[model samples]
Target: MNHQGWGAPPDDKGATPFAYPEQPVGGFPGAAPGVPFGSEPGMPQPWNVTDSFAFAWNRIKADPGTIIGTMLLGYFISNLPSTIARFIPSDEPSDETSLIVTIVLALLGGLFSTFMMGGMTLFTLNVARGSFYRLNDIFQGGPFFLSILGANLLIGLGVMFGTMLLIVPGIIIALGLCLTTLIIVDRRCGAIEALQQSWRLMNGHKLNVFLWWLMAAVVSLVGILACCIGTIVTAPLLQIAFAFVYLKISGQTTADSVGA
Candidate 1:
């Protein structure tokens, strides 16, 4: 599956014909292939953080409608379990019943969250690439859907189990695995492979990623303070920022063709 849009001809007789564009830092195609693409080694690229935030902001500015629509969808999906549980006739249910309900709701939320992440990643990639996208893009499921969902499930489970051991460890693991959804969408990798790949990319960059995430969290808290209406704007910004982060850390460009 050529998802990068490199325009390489299809393989014949089991040949793998696609090649990653040689993108070296400070220069286009002819620079040394192994050199880091856009910054000095060991020095964090300015765009790595700023560009993501900028792109996210751009999307929000350009298409407030789509941003709000997608975010509402996300909120609904995330809160579905609680919504359903509210109607269930549980007047002072026993501890066991409450535990079961909580577990079920958590599981449902996790599953929906994975699908939403995958779909949102695809939508952002499309928008970044200058392709026409619609609100429905947030729900499109393709061959890669299950793989992406599975990867998210594994990551969610890891976070949950890790939390059982210690809360801080779980948060760290969750952040470390943050890129798995994007990896699955971008690389067409299986669940385990996506998790492994995310782990690798995040290995030395955990602190940086955490800082960025914290920044986003702070911004989001401010938005929440504005009576939740700010989420319509903040959600899109965060998504686009995430798309930017996906591009930087994974060396992917939305300009690249999906399934190239």
Candidate 2:
């Protein structure tokens, strides 16, 4: 409850021992504590994904409300169209109406997803850089929405298209484009550029990222198991963890960490 603000609202126990240096925004929580002794200060310096979980968790604890609230809202909106479509029984056996409903639902879902992801990407990017944001940050993604949507669409197409060829190729395509959104958010690049960059960045690192994903997935299942509220914490933590991955692979550094 004593957010120093949100590491689940900052406590002596949870404030990241590591520092993410940023100027305290006028209305947000005061600046984070100074960098811990071992803090590095340069690019390509990878933060350990596993160890950074504590830090990421602390970040979530700092502002669980905004983060969780935004997530819940996104979840609702994204699923609402489908939920509605499901209830709308096809009038005739032709199924054209049902097909239209399905198409509309898919489009709505895509829009909601783009909006949510843009916000999440922005949120994670801010946190990784040691900045705090207001709840509105969730909607702030509108600016990047187009790029995020396009990136996702393209990545999906690549994966699906490849899957049409072979399951193995599809899997490969998926892993390769995993970092596409991050690239778009950070570099503010176009979808194709981001996908290309993600593929390149993931080069020689897909296996490690996959391992990290598996580990996070297990943790995620734990949250899902907890009647899903646990996801309020785990979901953001996963995002932050991947942010670290992107930062490391791209040779970007947080406020204090540097590459050794």
Model 2 lDDT, full chain set: 0.64
Residue-pair clash count for candidate 1: 8
Q: Please report the candidate that would top lDDT against the real structure.
A: 2
- TM-score, prediction 1: 0.68
**Cα-based lDDT for every prediction:** 0.63, 0.64
**Tens-place lDDT digits, model 1, residues 88-128:** 66657576786688779877876666656666676775565
**Residue 193 displacement (Å), model 1:** 1.1
Per-residue lDDT, model 1, residue 100, is: 89
Worst 10 residues of 2 by lDDT: 1-10
**Which candidate number would show the highest TM-score if scored against the true structure?**
2
**How do the residues 1-260 of candidate 2 rate in per-residue lDDT, one tens digit apiece?**
11110111122312433222332332223222442211222245555657567667766676678766766665676577778877878878688978887898888877777777766776676666565555555655554566677677677888899999999898888989998787665654566667777788778777777788788989999999999988877877888777767767776554235211
